[model samples]
Target: DPPLPRDVWLASTEVFLARGSAGSSDGLTLVAKGGHNGEHHNHNDVGSFLVAVDGVPVIVDAGRPTYTAATFGPDRYDIWTMQSAWHNVPVVRGRTQPAGRDATARGATAEIGDDASTFTADLAAAYPDAGLDHWRRRARLDRVAGRVEIDDAWRFADDAPTGDDTLLHLLVAGDVRLETGGARVIPEGGARPVRLRWPEDVAATAEVRHLDDPMLTEVWGGHLTRLALPLASRTQLQVTVELDTPIEDSP
Candidate 1:
């Protein structure tokens, strides 16, 4: 018998980036995924993110029901939960990433640290059908600063026509307040709040879509909010979501 190493090793999913655990750092964690849409149990989602704190899910995935005969069949994308529009990603024009292995992200890089982490993925190939020439998403998590930042940069093909057609989606539970250039989301049971700050100079709008499904309402209560970040008037965009810890009252 051989002596075992003190620290256990882990393998990669080849498509995701993460930090902390459900309860680590007082229940704080950050996750970002980049991959092809043709994966098993796949959702047409690339360059998406999930964040949780204090065992509370702030930004999350949508209602996924029990699987049946049709879950894995050709009708997978028919489910709302498995569609790109329902995910936490930017929508280019009125198009969503296609359902194919060739619809993938590229040049993925991650820099992990004790107090900070950064991830970058090129998502242009994921939306070739949209006439996308180049698209990139970068995520930066600052534990000390209690913030998660997302920067999306994209451009259309040289010969393709250009128009401002873009929207960014962020799904959350609990109380929410939508402002002109940003939004505030507080998780249920009164956990820390997440503050979203986007470019105000660009024309933007926010809307909430309330879910009516029984199971979904059991978790998220009413609905989720999607941010329509103006993408037609520019070639690059940046969005930041800051975590605001509740102020404890002194006895």
Candidate 2:
């Protein structure tokens, strides 16, 4: 309440990433993820994310699919939901991600700060079986900009052929609409909608699928929705999911 300052604003640490949060009740929270594909219990998601708005999980993790005795067997990865294609990540060079320690997410780092925070991953090792030479993914939780930004850049091995299917995915319990350049998704609780966009220069198609899995059925009470992108690439690409309703902007 100083006269030198025309206005006074409060500051709070809203980012919860590598650094632990100093508990508060300001009602804003954002988390950045870091992990490799080969981690025994982490599953096949190498570059995925979990986002919440007003404490409501908007972009969710497609958690444990139904179980069978074979689910514990060597063939566990054969389960469709166990693959990377079903998570909030991308598929490289037409290959669904493999499950193994050798298939990994490398050099994962996260930086938390007052203005914004960032998390990055070197995904090259995660796609070795897909003929990849190098792959990197960067994600930013911009508290100032009120959106998360993602940039994925990759290259194929010298002898690798041109691609057929290169794409990304996001799993949700929300309703999704395919639009001109991206998609509009209403969060699971039917609160505000989130707009996920791809650049106009990049060619991408968005579609939602209804799944009738035995496990997803028992959990969510119905078929789940997955947003998929079949992409046309050029060694680099960017996709951004904008939270149309950022907490700071809401009443």
Candidate 3:
């Protein structure tokens, strides 16, 4: 099999897709987005991402539910799936990202290469009321290393809430099992399991949401799981994701 084309960066959309070559047993792909919160039919999910191993989405996006009368109303964000806390984003100071074009990403950059693909952006503007001076999120897919690393570093304003106030979330279409310093995501179907490792200081937890809505169930089957990591009382957090190598690639 030939190598896949290099990673893609959509500058206008502020979305990046990074992946290993097609022939690589480590068929890992990461899709990350950084755009304004006020997109049409949008979720308050700037700096959100998804992970797929061997073409199966493990860390995923819980797609929008069926449109209701209130779907486009002022209460649109009241829906859990429309909130940043439920998406693969950080909730800072207990505040989800605000919805508006004013709430946008800044200083976004991407570098596509054979060794690694990287996308980085400052997300502080996406949380207008979160009292953040800067929230820098870096998503890097290292083809040589066979892993994807998400690094988030932030600086809080003086008045921002103190004590473990930052929580990162990743929604998954899989079974999640907690381990020593991280968790393993075994995607339903026949996809290889993916490991999500975090810093020792971060506390990892999982939540399962059963999908009763037909719109959601049709795509995700019965349910989805959310892996939540509450950062230590600190300014930075890094989550590394690794996909198991195929048997043929083993020594």
Candidate 4:
């Protein structure tokens, strides 16, 4: 099939997608979303994103669990997949986004450039009680560089959390090996490992999540990896799909 668009900016929904030109095995597809917490089949993930390499989803959304009485109950937010902390979004002071239409992204904008596409939004509204004055997330897809960069600039109403309260999450449909500034995501089915990099100050942790839910396992195989990074304000994260250099399996 023909390659997807080089750049796509859905301004109304604040979602952006970018893919590399055809013919390069190392090309990447990036998807980013910024909206209210109360989306249709909401996930409380206002600034979540995903990355795919060679049609294999490396960074993923994990979708939803099987529907049940508890799925839509008043305590629906109790579900792990429904929380913002479980998605590829930032967690502030150990708090994720709250549910409700009132919890929305603000000052959202998109730009489709020749070489890169960018989507920026203020996610402070979606995460109330985090003492945030503003949480600005900017995701840029650079087709020329075959990478996606996400920059997060945040300001707190009071003193910023000096401890490990500020964190970042990335759910992956692959094996993750934690490294200095990031992790190498080894995709299932023999796809090459993609590199995810972050600032030096951020500490990375990998948790293996075995999918027991049939619905989740069907889409993501038997397991997934969650890369959690304890970070500070004004952090930048990057995902690079390399054309060369194979990553060796860890013993």
Candidate 5:
């Protein structure tokens, strides 16, 4: 079958909520579900939440069990990837700290510290009604490209560091629109066929087009593209073409 159109928004949503969460009113609560045998590894059972506190929304998860409240002081947010059960575990909205090196060697680790007493004191002084559970929501946006070339750097609002071979989801706020030419769909191996194309005036050894029919959404066929170069940490990348456009509603 021919590859379907790409849905950039849905892909972003998957990336945004890749970490699970538990619903809460004032604060967000994340729970890691799975057997505590300390033997097997499981990613599907974990969950997270984005809590709104003092007008600052933060994400909380139970993925990094090796970390403690002490590891994260009072103030500052951070993103970390830890080695747990032989997997690179991603922990968002946590504390930050300096470390020598990771013993697991699975991935990079990040830490953020928050002075419990000082943080509480500041919150209490500013918003008397604000409690520890009070947190704000975070604004996130993302996008994916299949074959086009990008010029700018990609920025991650969250403190998570960007690295080569890191699978990412580009999230956007509302619907998006884009245009492209000379696109085609092709299937790889046993996986679903993908949309592909070549630019009109670009010279390259291989074809360069957006990946159509990304498995995430039905909007723009969920185009998937790769980075020509590694994305810089906390930097925004410029896209020359509309690889993954957004749609408010789809048929």
Candidate 6:
């Protein structure tokens, strides 16, 4: 048999199925069946193939895109795995131009297991003005993936206007046991009324509340509130803490 065309080599799948080009559009369709005769619950065997018309070969399917990208090379082609529902597979598309941008925003069908930061950075580079709040929110959600226990400690500047109720939202994505402890206070008021708003999706396993003495009475007071959130997949834990004291006027 004569050597397959470059396009054929880049676009064809090993699975024996009906493969053909759509003609007008630069897309290929591949139909996979369980057996050679294309019978036996074959409805679940269906999948779509997408190829970018550019000189390079970029393909998307139901599996991981990294495998395709590596096989094709970054210079020659790219692949994306589309999110699917039931037997109908959806191949997500992300703009390959503009260099770097989050694949999710552009409808990336593939998921990055461990390189969330790098992926987010790439998306940011691709779309300079792309608001990263969504990515940031997702990153925070991704952190609580495996174990049931979660321990996070960080300091946030309480610089919001006093008397103006402000809410800090913390979204936890996975199921986890949480323990929170911190100090926050207003220099003027000894202790401001701060409340913890647990995410409706998550369960509050335990909570420990404590108020520490004002560290800097001259500048601003600080108080801390901590709680634990237990959640499951697709479950979100939102903690809304409020600061209810008037911010001291600057001298």
TM-score of each: 0.83, 0.77, 0.91, 0.89, 0.17, 0.19
lDDT against true structure, model 4: 0.78
| Candidates 5 and 6 compared by TM-score, better number | 6
RMSD of each: 4.8, 7.9, 3.6, 2.8, 18.1, 24.8
Candidate 6 lDDT tens digits, 1-251: 43322212212222221112212221222222111112221211122222221111112122322233444344322221121221111111221212221222221122223311101111122222322222111111121221111111111123212121111212111111342432222212233322234445444443222223232212221322222333223212233223334447799
Positional deviation of residue 233's Cα in model 4 after best superposition, in angstroms? 7.1
Q: Using alpha carbons, what is the TM-score of model 3?
A: 0.91
For model 6, the superposed segments whose C-alpha errors exceed 4 Å read 1-135, 138-189, 207-225, 243-251
Tell me how far the alpha carbon of residue 70 in candidate 6 is from the true structure, in angstroms, after superposition.
Answer: 43
For candidate 5, write residues 134-215 as lDDT tens digits: 2112222122221222122222344446444322112111112222422222211122222222243322121122423232
Task: Assess each prediction's global lDDT (C-alpha) against the native.
Answer: 0.71, 0.62, 0.84, 0.78, 0.22, 0.23
Which model, 2 or 3, shows the larger TM-score? 3
Tell me the deviation in Å of residue 114 in model 4: 2.0
Query: Sorted by lDDT, highest first, which candidate order results?
Result: 3, 4, 1, 2, 6, 5
**Arrange candidates by TM-score, highest first: which order?**
3, 4, 1, 2, 6, 5
Q: lDDT by residue for model 2 over 1-251, one digit each (tens)?
A: 21221111121211124211234212223444445555655568776766554445556666777678767888888776678887777777777767776776677766657666677777878777777777787776666666667777877777454465877777765666767677676665545677778766544554455557766765554655666655554666676666675336556
Question: For all candidates, what are the clash counts?
Answer: 2, 0, 0, 0, 54, 26
Q: Which residue runs of candidate 2 sit more than 4 Å off their true CA positions? A: 1-34, 159-162, 201-221, 245-251
Name the regions of candidate 1 deviating beyond 4 angstroms: 1-12, 15-28, 159-162, 245-251
**Model 3 stretches with alpha carbons more than 4 Å out:** 1-5, 22-26, 159-162, 245-251
Please give the RMSD of candidate 1 to the true structure: 4.8
| lDDT score for residue 134 of model 3 | 93
